[model samples]
Target: MPMTVRSNCTGTLPSVIAGSAYTCSRCAEPHDGPPLGYGTPAPAYWNVEAADQPGSVLGEEQCVIAGSYFFVRARLVIPISDLDAEFDWGVWVSVSEASFERMSALWDKPERVEEPTYFGWLSTALPLYEPTTLNLKTKLHTQPIGDRPLVELEPTDHPLAVEQRTGITSARVQWIAEQILHTNPPMG
Candidate 1:
């Protein structure tokens, strides 16, 4: 595929929000809407309280530093189908465009794509690891100490660790940690 640096924001949004209900002058402009590329939305069940509400774009930024082409920041509302569920969480997703598109294409389709390109939860607004240290540590920690990967994450007191304890999609957190592991695996 030819990688043209063409800056155009074009993709499928929820059909429900296609018209005046969600119309914005920005949508017509390339630079105004979320950066154009492949991506997916946060899961529908990320926020249980906003069952009736739709997910909205909070912001987006190109992030070469993090290794992703772009990151779509969104406020996901995971609907509460369980009547006993007490409340919902206000969470953000830092995801790849390819992942976002997969979710978007299945917005109202009968067959939905369960997997996205990649994404991670914003367990907390605070930075869990410093940029410089994160790169080095993710590489070291994901390595195997014995039979299992070390996973000796630094600053264990960080909110991300708390998110792990609370079951806020630790898979996503692991995905982020595994980036380095996948990029540079052990040579045997």
Candidate 2:
């Protein structure tokens, strides 16, 4: 499945504000602003075979492959130093069956945030990061009823983790947008 990049702003590039006349390096067109979020439609482990298997399930917020491998879509938030809004990666994490069941049971409840953080492994392979952004240690933090769970990486020297901790600049966000847009064609 193709990854989806979503921008709350109306522009085509990442800029300080919407409708900014920033010329894109890739397309040379004036872009509005950067996308606030990017997401993979399924976990990295998911494939055509997995999708065809019995008992496999894939939904907007959750995934189960062969009734064994469990995944939940969560937000990996990185604060932007120069912007008021933060950047987010809509990534998936692998969790144990027990954790998946507990999360499902409380999926619609307002008190689900009271549950302790669940240990998980990052299952999305993000581009533009060296040493692959796969299998990093993470904690799935349940949010309010309407929000996706937050993915907190285990403190490490990984670039993604470091960015999450210390934040990134608007320039970095723009570079990210450029790389992603240039590489992945817009979906129909």
Task: Report lDDT per candidate.
Answer: 0.27, 0.85
Model 2 misplacement above 4 A? 7-17
Off by over 4 Å in 1: 1-87, 121-157, 163-188
Error of 2 at 95 (Å): 0.4
lDDT digits (tens) for residues 108-145 of candidate 2: 99999899999999999998889899999999989888
lDDT of 1 by residue, 1-188 (tens): 11111111211222111121212232332222111111122322223343333433323321222233333332222121322111122223334466545544554554442332243434213222343212112111111111111122233555434433343332332232233223333222
Clashes in each model (backbone N, CA, C under 3 Å)?
15, 5
Candidate 1 lowest-lDDT run of ten:
139-148
TM-score of 1: 0.27
Residue 138 lDDT in candidate 1 = 17
RMSD, candidate 2, Å? 3.2
TM-score of 2: 0.91
User: What TM-score would each prediction reach against the true structure?
Assistant: 0.27, 0.91
